[model samples]
Target chain A: MTVLGYLANGLVFSSIIVLGSIGLSLVYSIADFANFAHGDTMTIGAYTALVTFGAVGGLGGAVLGLPYGFFLALVVGIAVAAVVAVGTEKLIYEPLDVDSIGLLITSIGIAFIYRAVIQIRFGSDFTRFGIQSLRPIETLIPYGVRVTLHDVAIVASAVVLVAGLHVLLQYTDLGRKMRAMADNPDLARVSGIRTKRVKLWTWVIGAGLAGAGGVFLGLFNQLSPRMGFNLLLIIFAAVILGGIGSVYGAMAGGFLIGMITQLTPFFSNVVEALPIGQGWLATLLENLITLEYANAIAFVIMVVVLLVRPNGIAGEGAT
Target chain B: MSLLADPKAAFADLTRPERWVLGVSVAFMLFLLGALLTGALGPTYFLFLVGLAGMYALLSFGLNAQWGFTGLINFSVAAFFGIGAYGSALMTAESSPIAGGFNPLVGLVVALVVALVLALLIGIPTLRLRADYLAIASLGLAEVVRLVVLNERWLTNGSAGVRGIPSFFKGWPVLSTFPETMPGLRLVVIPGSPIILGTSFWEALLNVLLVLTFAGVTFLMLRRAHQSPWGRVLRTIRSDEDLARALGKNTYSFKMQSFILGSLIMALAGVFYTHLNLYVGPGDLDPITTFYAWVAVILGGSGSNRGALFGGIVIVTIREGTRFLNDFAIPIDPAPMRLLLIGIVIVAVMRYRPQGVLPPQRELIWPSAVDGGGTTETPDSGVREQKGGGGDE
Candidate 1:
């Protein structure tokens, strides 16, 4: 595939990653823990949409190859994911006396519980939505960019949601409160910002975005028990790359990580064509820069980022 | 040794909850022993369970050293374990892509050396950062290692896995052939059931012995380290890194040492597992194994060695018990059930007893330094301080 083709794919994938990373970063800042369950929350959203779409079916006309029912299912998925996160916070995380690290570990357990329950209900198999798959647009195919209408739908929806979020954060009362809480919870609490309520809102927005991401991800690929989990490390890399706790940073980080992951094969091809010296270095690059190592490449990039810029690309200077 | 010599005194030393744990553990062991004698469980399989328990204990010991003793969240326990397993398997297995048919001892040495190098590679970058950075980076790096093992067929045999692995005592003279040479015995433990002891049983006995040696040596070394000034420094670092540094101690080096030590122990567990199972595969490098060790260490009491041992046994029980339930009782799959149980255990432990079931109770001051100071009573103030202060990010 050409660079444009890879870039188009990256754009579609990055939409889902951006959705997932925003929630994770928001929760990390406000909740004060690296929630290992955030990915599973995405899984919950995906599976909920799967069941919802299965039950509701196509209601009428289709836009971008997805039925109106899918849009309905998407809303339900988002609501369910948000509700679950809030419930877990109230029932488990709120009463716990442990610190952020303890909450971090507890989140792992929550991740497992979310996954296990889904596995029990779904039987660990991969499935797709009732919507039919669409072929790449003919005009785009000729230009070496082969994104389908569904891909366009995903990206367009993501852009709308992100824009809505931007407006909410920048202009709305809840947004201001959330930003304040993320910056300094103690200060926000002292200033009568109602940190608990803001935190609940954060869970709602973060997990709702994650749920939407999960639904789009299922549309993009296929839904399995491990679909969200498999993508989790990449999402984390994005969050870390953008600077943990920064919402806008997560968006940029998600875009870059997603692009790098999809463009790995192209990079390897470029390496093979380049007139680099024919030695072990060349051979190693050729061997390591394959599709199989795409995720590994993202992980390696995350480690390097952690090494050089621990606070992330857009984060404030290191303490 | 002191506990064995003065049972009454040791019993008096235990907290009420610890006493309950001991009683339940003893009852459980006696029940298993009863089942063994009645031919309800196969001796070989029973011995294999013991070996698995020991292996998990070793893994827990490794995590305890890092997370418990030093407050370093090294999330790549399974990576080091996989490295050790693959390192040994690639050297000793007949189907190894690089080299094969080497002595098991050489495989052992190779596994440890490779683990050492990998530990240093992973530790150098993340150990200098915040505690959670190690957690995140190690997890990501572990995925990289798993991907490499899964994709690099020439180096690791890929998903087909290294096969035809010999036993740990493959070339140990009499021990190598002892399983085969031993005569089979049949004992009518019950009227209709005949308990048989054969070659497999002897082999399992040998494996149990091998695991016991590994766990025993690791236990001794950790005990010595945990009591020494080195361990005290680590504990101090765990509670308050600034305090340790203020006292002119290099916290980074201490963290690195603890990280390497824990990783080495995890690798040792993996080496034992490779021999015990006689196979190594990409699936073995699953993050589940890392979480299993984490669950074991945390459930057993973070800084307590005996708790780790107990936790290891409990893990085996939970692991095998779920399978047993699936086969004989419920038709539900054991996989999700196990995950659910682990999840509940973690949440419950954190909710009710975050310090674990058997938290380290005694102070960790050096014996010689305190002997002449006339402080005979070992107060657990350090442990209390750790519980309060260790979670500082």
Candidate 2:
């Protein structure tokens, strides 16, 4: 594929990653814990949509090659994911008396529970939505960019959700309270902000976005027991690269990381074409810059970022 | 000797909960012994279980050193374990892509050196950051290692895995042929169901001996280090890094040492596992193994060596018990059940008993300092108390 083809694919993949990173970053700031269950929360959303679509059926007409029922399934997926996160917080995280690291460990347990329950119900196999797959648009293929209408729909919906979030954060009362709590929970609570309520809302918004990301991811690829978990570290890399607590930074970081992951094959091709002498250096680059090492490349980038810029790219001050 | 004669007086120092734990452990061991004598559990399988427990104990020891003592959250436990397994497997397995037919002792050496280098590579970047950064980076390191193993077919044999691995005592003069040389024995323990001690049983006994050696040496080394001024410095770093730094301790260097030490122990467990299983695969490096060690350390009581050992045995029970349940009792799969059990244990432990079932309960001052003072100091005001609530930051 041409560079444009890879770029298009990156755009679609980045949309899902951006959706995931935003939730993780928000919770990290407001909830005050690196929730390991956030990825499983995405899995919850995807499976919920899978069951919803199977139950609801086509519901008549279609748009962008997806049935109306799929959209309904998407909404249901988001709602269920939000409800589950809230339930876990109320029943587990709230009553517990431990520091953030303790909560972090607890979150791993939560992640396992979510995944095990899913595996019990669904079995450890891959499945897809009832919606039929679509082919790349003919006009785009001629221009060396091949993306189906489904991919466009995913990107468009992500943009709409992200824009909605931007307006909410910049203008709305709840968003302001969330931002305030993210900045300093004690100050916000002292200033009459109901921190608990804000925290609950953060779970809702973060998990809700993650749910949408999960739905899009299932549509982009096949849904499996490990689908969300497999993507989790990459999402974490995105969140960290953007600064853990910053939502806007998460978007940029998600985009860059997602692009790099998808463009690894193209990068390898470029390396093969480069005339940078014939020695161990050339051989090393050729061996390392392959598609199989795509995720490894992202992880390496994350470690490097941790070393040079521990606070992340958009972090305001030293942590 | 007096305590053995008067059990009640021996138990006087232990708390009520500690006494209960001790009673339950004794009862459980007796039950297992009864089952073995009845010929219900095969001797070979029983010996294998012991070796598995010892291996897990070694893994837990490694994590205890890093997470328990030094407060470094190294999430790449499985990576070190996998590197150890792969390191040894590549050196000794017939199907190894690079080189094979090497001595198992050489494999052990290579595994430790590789683990040491990898530890330094990963620790140097994240140890300087906040505690959580180490957690994140180490997790990434695990994934990277797993991917490399899975993709680099030429180096690791990819998903096909390395097989034809010899036993741990492959090169030993007498031990190499000991299993074959020894005559098989059969005891009619239960009339029709005689307890058989065949070649496999002898081989398993040898594996158990090997693991015991590894775990025993690791335990002694850790005990000595953990009770010294050096371990006191690490505990201080765990509870309060600034305090240790203020006292002119180089916390970074101490953390690196702890990280490397723990990683080496985990690698040692891996080397043992490769010999025990006689094969190594990329799937062996799954993140589940890392969490298994985490569960072992936290549930066993962080910073407590005996607790880690207890936790390791408990983990093996949970792991093997689920398989046993699936085989005979229920039709349900064991994998999800094990995950659920692990999940519940973690959440319950955090919620109810965050200090764990057997938290460390002794002071860590230098033995010489206390001996020279010649004053009886209360053990109550020990490392756990100084650790305050929530052992980790």
Candidate 3:
């Protein structure tokens, strides 16, 4: 309703992309494909949270506290999503071992399987995290901008996860291996870096992030089979616009693209409600752009970024 | 040894592998042809499904040209197909606030031209990128096209879709008056049968014929093109653009040509599809359409035109045949299961035989010796290399 609401919404939306794009950029850097199914993997993670809550609701509520139970669900979601991601790589992608294009096609197949399985099990209906039960705490920021507790939780978790990732990449041996592999798989192998192990870890970290991102996204709005697929283009835009395979770039691009996507529609609505009683301009603006153009906006941004800098803003070159 | 050394016998000699290949191919073709003929004869629904399969075959053929031959990953097959369907439907629909009310022939021309132009526009800027980037960009482009169709009510009637577009040969005197003017032509294959030649039946028959004609023409043209110098250049680029460029070829121009040609063919499929259904909708242009064609191309073999056709029919049959799942007493909905199976099939195909049912064949050039002294590496191997390294200058 208010411009601040849109700003808050944009930050929440950008955090999800930030979380999701890290895994995507990681996998793209190391595995050498876009992993078209990454979005669906995020969906699976969100569904994991749903299943977790359903199974442990009584025990978690009775034993651990409410917040702890919810936290437990998020952890379980991250674990299950990681396993599924690794399993897909082993069963489908690793065996092919062809090229990026082959892997891309294989990922598409995996995406279809993931989507269809979710639809079959869940019946394609919209589900939610019962955020209402939380009776979310709202606080007013500067300029009277209201923010909810759910938004705070999502943003906080994203910050923690991203920082953790940054520490891992900068300091850990496994993270160094991943970076080396991403830089040059052949050279990494020649240097006896155990590329396979790095790849395994890549999926674990990437898919785990996807799962957390999915849960946050579901919390932000609703959960459905289409949730991840719908946001796939935007996630892709963020990944590419930031520079493929660059973690920090993915984060920056995610926020930039997310703000643009959400804020464009918000601005459009605001302008349309203005007291300028001109009918034709409103009609023209409505036709030229609408909220549904969110996907288009992402796409256009990605294309423009690619045209200007083929490797993306952060990319050194093709990974 | 004496029998093997006989010069006269050697003239007709065939390798054991060659004979096996011939036998298996012929048998497969016969089986498919038999299945199609029998199904068409048995039920009216059979004709529709079979015709639809033929249309898919055409779609795969177009994809085969791009991915199979040119090593281009096109995620916009559905967009081009949509262009074909909507282009024709908008032009030929009876004059309304939104439609042009032109003849279907004009619609066909417009569809081809639109497809060509769009392909050029999308390809020119993006084709030089890496294969994965192109895939990403094309995927975005497809969504853009579908979104445009969904939102532009003034042009595409929004999401409700255009309906009741005139079918092919609607109100044509030759077809409408066929029963009276050509009594002999009305003879049914089933002698003395009570089945009367109805207008719907004729339309179905004509559609089948039309699809077959398009498939046949597309297959022949593609085969010829691939065998020509132009096709060879495409293969060279697909294999290694650097090599092609070093050889003094303008690889960009060639890639563009391949892209546009494949798109033109895909658009043709879309035109026939609209006439067959007599409707066009944004739903018809989803990513799933592109996926279906990709399955066909992958299953059949990417570079082989015949393989593309084979893959199309097999994929379509699997798709249509799954409708029988309704008869089973499954607790859950069968629709999702069908898609799940298709997904598995694509994964399985990629894993076990990435080359497809038939590995793309090299141009057979007979020489004085069985092993030709050729210095050039085969295109199939080149296309299959680690393409991840591509897209960088």
Instruction: Give residue B235's error in model 2 in angstroms.
Output: 0.7
Candidate 1: segments with Cα more than 4 A from true spot: A317-319, B1-9, B363-393
Listed in order, the DockQ scores are: 0.76, 0.74, 0.59
lDDT of 3 at B252: 87
Model 1 chain B: worst 10 consecutive residues (lDDT sum): B367-376
- i-RMS, each model, one decimal: 0.7, 0.8, 1.2
lDDT-best of 1 and 3: 1
Per-residue lDDT tens digits for candidate 2, residues B91-170, read 99887899998999999999999999999988888789787778888999899999999998999999999999999899
Candidate 2 C-alpha RMSD relative to the actual structure: 4.7
What digit string (tens of lDDT, one per residue) describes model 3 on residues A40-141?
999999999988877766453322123556677899999999999998888778878578888899888898899899999998889986435444343465
TM-score-superior candidate, 1 or 3: 1
lDDT by residue (A219-294, candidate 2, tens digit) is 9998987888888899999988998889998988999999999999999999999998898989999999999899
TM-score of 3: 0.87
TM-scores for chain A over all candidates: 0.98, 0.98, 0.90
- Clash number by candidate, in order: 0, 0, 1
Tell me the spans in candidate 2 whose CA falls farther than 4 Å from its real position.
A317-319, B1-5, B363-393
Instruction: Order candidates by DockQ, high to low.
Output: 1, 2, 3
- Model 2 chain A, TM-score vs. native: 0.98
Q: Model 1 clash pairs?
A: none
